[model samples]
Target: MTNSSGTITDKTGAPVTIADDPDNHRYTVTVDGVRAGHAAYADRTDDHGVAQRVFYHTEVDEAFGGRGLATILVKEALDDARAQGRKIVGVCPLVAAFLKKHPEYSEATSPVTKQILDWLKR
Candidate 1:
């Protein structure tokens, strides 16, 4: 997988940075070098570096809504996960909804997402 580096600026000219925190194994997304979004997760492995259960929580700045910043964040988060060879467990409603709307991105999801979708089925 190709990692998108350099910078992706928001409408206000803020550079986007999606970084994974080694300690928490979560992601912190920044725009223009300032925090615009974040996602917390749990990464567990057994005798190997493989990820087990990755529960995620993501949120976007309200001011950045309607501009697809949330989608951008999700895309970056999923891209990072794919590069790291990890699956996702989206605990955030925003991410869950995004997944429901874009089945193409479901490749990043874990088995738990199906259970979550059971309740989210329309």
Candidate 2:
């Protein structure tokens, strides 16, 4: 999960911070320095030179569940990939389901293949 904190948005004046922890291969979301959620992914470049971000798991702490943190985690993770011109791959069911619900991100998602899933497991 992320360690370097940065503010992303502020709707009610309380900022939400998202940070990257590449050593852990995940992005973490924190509120007021308290960890709230995270989205984990594996990164690599495809043979075609496309940056691929394969998200495998995303979760919010039980105490923070239903506070829309999971949505924020996914959005931050996906948007980060998009900003890097990377295509997202959904190996985790949660990510796949999220994409289905929010097709706005469909254009940036990479097609899932056996190879992608196999690589994520490693």
Candidate 3:
């Protein structure tokens, strides 16, 4: 979408939107109003005494695949969590992979417990 700053967006005229939906326990990613991807998580406590969320799944719609939407979606989700003084546990394989590629966030990630990991499978 074109804002006051005159930045252009996708064909639908809506700029990319990313936000944490705490009620649903997932971060939603949208492209011009259409849901493009999401990063799912479960909330818990981290070692640093900060709130932690275990990212257990991340996915992009098949139509949105090959466009790096998942990467963008996950990055926004992770970045937002970090910005809020929260830590993340990368149980989601995609997120784990993302962390490896971006070590700058590695230190902010905490380990996931087996119980939490098992819960994610359900």
| TM-score top scorer | 2
Question: lDDT of candidate 3?
Answer: 0.79
Better of 2 and 3 by lDDT: 2
* lDDT to native, each model: 0.64, 0.81, 0.79
Q: Residue-wise lDDT of candidate 1 within 1-122, one digit each (tens)?
A: 12266557555555667777768766777766667667766665524455643545777778666555666777777777767777666667666677788788677676555544454343
Which portions of model 3 show Cα errors greater than 4 Å? Answer: 1-14, 46-50, 118-122
lDDT of 2 by residue, 1-122 (tens): 23346545433444678788899999998877898888888988988898899998888889766566677778778888889898999777888888889899988999889887777667
Q: How close is candidate 3 to the true structure, as a TM-score?
A: 0.80
lDDT computed for candidate 2: 0.81
- Residue 5's lDDT within candidate 1 is 62
> What TM-score would each prediction reach against the true structure?
0.66, 0.83, 0.80
Tell me how far the alpha carbon of residue 27 in candidate 2 is from the true structure, in angstroms, after superposition: 0.5
Comparing 2 with 3 on TM-score, the higher-scoring candidate is 2
Clashes of each: 2, 0, 1
Expressed as tens digits, the lDDT of each residue in 24-56 for candidate 3 is: 999987886899889998877644466887898
Which candidate number would show the highest lDDT if scored against the true structure? 2
Q: Kindly provide the TM-score of model 2 when superposed on the true structure, using C-alpha atoms.
A: 0.83
